[model samples]
Target: MNKTGKIYVVGIGPGSKEHMTFEAKTAIEKSDIIVGYKTYIDLIKDMLEDKEVASSGMKKEIERCTEALEYAKQGKTVSLVSSGDSGVYGMAGIMFEVAFKDESHVEVEVIPGVTAANAAAASLGAPIMHDYVTISLSDLLTDWSLIEKRLHCAGKGDFVVCLYNPKSKGRQQQIQIAREILLKYKNEDTVVGIVRNAKRAGESIVITTLGDMLKYEIDMFTTVIVGNSNTYSVKEKMITPRGYEL
Candidate 1:
């Protein structure tokens, strides 16, 4: 009987090698095979020279995870990569589900990396310093009604909101609708920070008001941080104060 090899779910972090956790880097180096979405694989092409790579396009997550598990079962160390922390809207959960369904005994390890919220917030000067909620606008798997409910709750709770997968070619209307929902609770002047391609190439940061945010360019790579009532902008930076007295 061949010994099963381990699988590592790695988060590459915001398309920048510097943002990747040391553990994540080490896992990729140790893996005999690297599997991930094509975009994520391209982000780390420098590290994949000697490794066997299997990359596919969007919406093929199940196929990627299954392939990684298969390689692991064949006694090959496998690294399954995601752009952000794998557990947060990444491949870690799906990988676990696949492994469990197959009743496979291969060991699995998850390495965390800086997620988009963290990277975008840092680039915009701590817009998430207070309590925050992260939501993905993509409704590919999740129903749009469920996502709308989450947006309403996040808005009513006065929580700093971080939006992922904000807008794409076919998904342009969701963000617009989200703004309207958030406006019911937040002030029109509430500080909003938009970070595109955070911590990566062609990064752009814009600090605007909730009412004015829509005027800026936003897309799938952009992270939109809508501040709570108390959050404010200063010196071109968006900040949500933690209520510490000066």
Candidate 2:
């Protein structure tokens, strides 16, 4: 609550009212204006119908934040909501870049929410409890070569890899390519968990080995968790539980 104005870059979690955190709910309830992508706004439409709302299309990340800033300049409490935790492949970083680049903006605070990583982990049963790393499969901003390099490194390091944006129409094979890269260091029997629409109404969680991954079709709503050598599956659940017994 600073004089420059206040912007709450809020994360709404994975498209579910029950999964949304209390703090995130409180922030949304208190906000004077809610700005976000159209689908996300529609997801929480009932709670925000009375509030001033502004929504953008799928590919308008910067424009969305800029529009939120304009609302902030008017001394309105603006909430720029993201689908998952703002820090993890969400809108927080971009909003920060916009604020810093422009300068002289409102107080931007990122209120955290359950990300796909957390949701996927929960769905599949603690596959990232120990040392792990997260990577995004989208090559829109990053080069696929760099993604391959990182995938190789993560595989070599035996880190549990949480992957975001695993599959879309344009980049369907990116995850398959990453699986091939990881297979070099891992095994054909290495456990992998695919959680689609995690925590949402139509959520589905699948646990299979690396060899079976090609048979499964993923989407943008899916978050893929590929286990390390130490990880395994039990009763069809991919688990990387803390090594307490060992």
Candidate 3:
């Protein structure tokens, strides 16, 4: 009987090897096949030499995960790559779901990496030193009304909010709506940090107020962090005090 192969869900972390965790890299190195979105695969293409690569475009996540599972069942070690932490809006969940439903007895391991929130926060100093919530404005799978409710709750709770997939060409108004919803609870002067292409090429960091964040350029590659009431900006760095009584 052939041994069932293993699958490793690896997070690449901000499209740069420097930001990727050692474990993530190791899984890719050990895998016989690497599968991921084309953009993410390109980010680490150099390391994938002599390896079988299966890449697809956006919205093909289900196809990608299914392919990885198929490869694993065929006794091939597979690495499913995702940008940022795999468990955070990445491929890990879908992979597990597919595996469970199919009852594929393949060994699976999830290797975490620097998620967008962490990478964006580090780029603009510590804006989430206290309680925070990470929300994605993309309504691809989630309902818009549900997202609004989450935004409203995050605002009312005064939790530092990290927004992913803030905007894109076809979906532009969601970010604006998010800003308006957050403004209902957060003051106009609340610090907002925007980090684009974080830890990768063409990286840009903006420290602005929630009232003026929309004025700056934002897109899918950007991560926006809205500071809590206690958060502030000093010397161009956004900081949220942890209330250590200093």
User: Which candidate has the top score in lDDT?
Assistant: 3
Q: Which of the predicted structures, 1 or 2, would earn the higher TM-score when compared with the native? A: 1
Off by over 4 Å in 1: none
Candidate 1 lDDT tens digits, 1-246: 888999999989997778988899999999999999999999999999998999999999999999999999999999999998999999999999999999999999999989999999999998888899999999999999999999999999999999999999999999999999999999899999999999999999999999999999999999999999999889988889999999
Q: What is the lDDT of residue 3 in candidate 2?
A: 49
Residue range 122-192, candidate 2, lDDT tens digits: 98987998999999999999998899999999999999999999989888789889988999999999899
Question: Across residues 155-230, which tens digit of lDDT does each residue of candidate 3 receive?
Answer: 9999999999999999999999999999999999999999999989999999999999999999999999999999
**Overall lDDT per candidate, in order of appearance:** 0.94, 0.88, 0.95
Ranking by lDDT: 3, 1, 2
Clashes of 2: 0
lDDT (Cα, 0-100) at 173 in candidate 3: 97
The CA lDDT at 83 in model 1 is 93
Error of 3 at 228 (Å): 0.5
